[model samples]
Structure formats: C-alpha cells, structure tokens
Target: MARVLEVQGVSKRFLGLKALQGVTLHLEEGEILAVIGPNGAGKSTLLNVISGLLRPDAGRVLFLGRDVTPLPPEARTHLGLGRAFQIPTPLPELTVRENLLVGALFGRPGRSRKEAEAMVEAVLELTGLAAKAEAPAGELTLLEDKRLELARALATGPKVLLLDEVMAGLRPKEAQEAVDLVRRIRDAGVSVLFIEHLMPVVRALADRVVVLDYGEVIAEGPYEQVAREERVREAYLGRRA
Candidate 1:
C-alpha cells in the first residue's frame, strides 16, 4: 500500500515549551492509524502540524508524496487533506446540509455550487445525516453533532482524513457506531489518521498505533503489541517507585 501521508522529523515549540520533537509517522492508503498518548504527549500538536493549522519549527509534512509543509489549512484541504476537529461546532443558524455545503464548496478551490451540493448529499448519506439534512445544526444531539463534524470533513472529498478525538465524548455504543462509520469511510477510499484517547476505540479501529511521550514517539506497531510495551505503560501510568 502506498503512503498517503508522512511526517518527517517534525517538531514544534510554544515559547519555551516543546510541544513536539522530531516526531515521525505515516498513514498508508486505506489504513486507519491511531496516535495515542497521555496528556501533554504532543498528539494534538502533531495533528495541528499535519493538518496545516500550525507550521512545525522544523521538518516536513508530505501528503500523497508532495511536500505541504508551507501550505495553509485551506491549501492542504484543497490538496486532499481534510480534518475534523475534536469539538463539533457547526454553525447554529445554518441547517446541517448547509453546513456541509460550506465545506464542500470552500474546501477545494474552484468547486462549483452544483458539485458542492452533490458532495454534500453524498456526505449526508454516508454520515447517516440525510434524514436530518434540513435540521438546524444547534438542535442536534451529541451523536448528531459528532456526525456533523465528521460529515463536514467528508464533504471536502479528502483522500486522507485527519480526525482529532472525534470519539472523545461518546458513550461506548455511540463510539461503536462511529467506529463502524469510519470503517465505511475507509472502505470508500479515505485513509484515516486519528487522535484517540479511548483505548477501546483504538483497539477496534486502528490497524496500527503510534504512541507519543514527552513530545516524541515512544512506540509504534500493532495495538496489542504496543499495548504491552513497558515504555507505553509508563507513559500512561507512572513507573513503580
């Protein structure tokens, strides 16, 4: 399988704080890769760098083999990198379908209104939001909000999707539904790189896992294999005194 996304020796700093240091990872075509870590482990920072929300202090971000380190978020999206935030914040005034239309139209430059509407309809169906397409975004339940967030990103017609803890606040059942939805997304040809705090979600969805600690990668491999690593254990649970 070809690599869809790559982060080479990426690092970031916020004043004196090192948010990430020489972090490296890759997402393969049609694969679901999860980035996991304890708090302050630079997982979010890495996602920001990959999605073009923040420029790394050093290193490169490659999307479909093209260096996109200098591109802005919209440019990256246009280049087939789409992202869904950890928090679902849809526009309250607009209907759910309209919210997705915004993404489809603007996510890729030069997309026509007809093309955007068609994309929105497809996303609405894929995300199980077609029934509520005309409902106000603010009136959605938690699960609906989450679906809208994921749907909006999908409307961009991304080759690789970057999801930032989209399963964070869901119940176990709801998360399972999300896991299934993501699988369908992948089957539809989107490679996924997601940040997840829910271990079960990672175990259920990720084909591979990357663990970050102290702003650096501590382990990378199959979920069960990485789960048993001593370093990974220490990252989440303090070492025995």
Candidate 2:
C-alpha cells in the first residue's frame, strides 16, 4: 500500500536544542500507528511538522505521494490531512454542532454550506456526540470535549488523521470508548498516526508502534516486540517503573 504520510530525514531545532534529528517514519493507508517516547522525545514536534504548525529545519513531509513541506496548515487540511490537538479547545460560545460545522465548512475550501451541514451530522453521529449536538461546546464534560475535538477533525474529510493524546484526561472506560471510536474511524478507511503516553491504549490501538527517544526512532514494530526492546525499556517503559 502507498504511504498516506511520510516524514523523511526530518529535523528541527530550537536555538541550541535539537528538538528532532533525522526522524523518519511513515503511515500506511487504513493502518493505525502509535508514536511513544519519554517526555520531550519530539513526538509533538513531529506532529506539528506534519500538520504544518512548524516547518522542519531539514527534511520533507509527504502526504499522499505529494510533497507538502512548504504548505500551510490550512492548505494541508484541504489536501486531506486532519489533526486533533492534545488539548480539546472548542469554541466556547458555539454549539457542538456549530463547532464541527466550522471545520467542515472551512477545513476544505469550496465545500458548499449544504455539504458542510451534511458532514456535521455525519461526524456528530460517528463521534457519538449527536445527543449533545445543541449543547454549548464549553459546557461539555472532558470526555465530550475530547470527542468534539476528534469530530471536528473528521469533519475535514481527511485521508489521514493526526491525533495528539486525545485520550489523555479520560477515565479507563472513557479511554476505551475513545479507542473504539478510533478503530471505527480507521475501519472507515482513514489512516491514523497518534502520540500516546498510555501503554494500554497504545497496545490496544496501534497496528505498529514507533518508539522515539531524544528525537530519534529507537524501535518500530508490533507492540509486544517494541515493548520488550532493552533501549525502549531504558528510555521510556522503565521510567514508568
């Protein structure tokens, strides 16, 4: 299968700090890949670069076989890339439905209002936020907020979804629900690349896992295989001990 997203020899720096160095990874269509590492391992930076929040000091970002290294975030969205932030930041005054509508209407330029509205309905249903469609976004519970964040991203009709710790604040049950939703999303033909801290979530969701330490990939394989790696244990899992 062709890669849905690719990061080739990517590097980024902040003054004297090397946030990332020669990072390389790829996401295959309809697959779910997880990126795991210790804090400050450049997981977020990789997502930002892929989503166009920051351009790499070196390397290329390819989306669907096209070089999108120079494209802006909105431009990338139009080309079928979607991202959900770690923090769910919903528009305070807007209704849940409206929040998704904003993404549907503006995420892909030239989408008709009618088309966006239809998309909003579909997304709300998919994310299980249909019951709260008319509620104020700011009034939602943390679980709902996370759902809304994911729904808004889906509203963009992306071929690949970049998720940043969407399960962070949820309870075990809630996290399971989120996991199920993500599985359904992947089943519906979208590729996913996510940064996650919870090992259980990563194990349950990732088809493949990539471990990063000090800004570089240390291991890439099935969860059990990568989990048993000595370096992965030393750099990340052991710290949880």
lDDT of every model, 2 decimals: 0.94, 0.94
RMSD of 1: 1.4
Tens digit of lDDT per residue, candidate 1, span 168-196?
A: 88999999999999999999999999999
Worst 10 residues of 2 by lDDT: 232-241
- Mark the regions of model 1 whose C-alpha exceeds 4 Å error after superposition: 239-241
Error of 2 at 183 (Å): 0.5
Model 1: ten consecutive residues of lowest lDDT: 232-241
lDDT of 2: 0.94
TM-score of every candidate relative to the true structure = 0.97, 0.98
